[model samples]
Target: MSPTIFYGQTGKFTFRMLATVLGGQSICILLGALVARAIAATDQGSGSSTAYLVVGVGLGALCIVAAGLMRRPWGVTLGWVVQALTLLSALVVPMMFVVGLFFLALWVTCLVKGAKVDAEMARREAAAGGSEAGADDDGTADRVDG
Candidate 1:
């Protein structure tokens, strides 16, 4: 297969991994928060932890939506929402567990994969000596321009 095809596949794989990891995290965090509330029920009003539940649900929704959308606009929006909720609900550690620091690491991997794929495509395109890649006036490859 072509380098573009291979790199593109790698990029796609990374994207999928990011989505799965983030989605899984959101669910786990929501579950953890529920467990915490159950344990705390003996001490105070269960209703008192409403903020935690709400944030967990919201963040979990965001992560789910983000995972569904991947790198699309909705995905970015949902990711921002998740990040905002994470910041606002800093008091809840379990929420982070569900939201996933591991997914953050996966996201970095996704970025690297995307960048590598892009670079490979650009290189291949340039080596093919296409005008789109800043070929010389005669269509020969040029070291610079694009």
Candidate 2:
């Protein structure tokens, strides 16, 4: 099995890792908005305040949507867009520069490491004589003959 083929399998580690990052980011965006409001940068009852909240909500929603889409190939592309938006949020909230960097690092790490692991899994599966089962973490392959 190729890495791409293996990655498409349900309940893979890469999917879990990337999904976690995006899910966590949704919460962070909301908190960041609250922080901006608390700092008085978003004037009370003003359009800027509402806009900030709206943007936060939108980004949070987008994160969830992206997470759901991760089973598809383009889902990863959507995640990249999320990262870009998070970094751009620094324009409104300076703290986002730090938050964005943290998440971005996680995203990249997960992609790189997860791909390697998946490719390893694919290699192992191939070596397992075309067994229906994938390799386990303990360097063993489960036999699942139909």
Candidate 3:
């Protein structure tokens, strides 16, 4: 059996990593929400705290789906949406403002660096292709000894 290769553009990898981070963050948010609910229970109730749970879980699921959708053109757009939602989460959990900012920085870095890496990879592939074509036309092997 042949081993499957998962090679692709660097941007995809970056987005996948972002998705993973978002999913993990979602779980953290859920835990925080539960704690918030317990605290609020002594005073008010779970009514407001439930919003955090719902939004947290929902964002987590969205991130997972967005990761899969990275192959599509709209995948990046979805990522932006996730970022916005993550920032908006600060409204509920004040600490999320800090966490969200950190993630936002990471997301931006990924996009910028991913594009650079992808461009370099494409350039290298094109050069390799050109070299291969020249060798074939000259009836020579494309490898060198020593």
Best of the candidates, lDDT: 2
What lDDT does candidate 3 reach at residue 135?
A: 74
Better of 2 and 3 by TM-score: 2
Model 2: lDDT of residue 70: 85
Number of the top TM-score candidate: 2
TM-score of each: 0.55, 0.76, 0.72
Residue 59 lDDT (model 3): 75
Give one digit per residue, the lDDT tens place, for model 2 in 95-124: 899999999999888777777886788788
Candidate 1 lDDT, 26-45, residue by residue in tens: 77667756755565565565
| Clash counts for all predictions | 2, 0, 0
Q: Can you tell me which runs of candidate 1 are displaced by over 4 Å?
A: 1-14, 94-100, 118-146
lDDT of 1 at 16: 72
**Clash count in backbone of candidate 3:** 0
Reference-based lDDT, residue 31, model 1: 78
Error of 2 at 82 (Å): 0.3
Weakest 10 consecutive residues, lDDT, candidate 1? 1-10
Model 2 lDDT at residue 7: 33
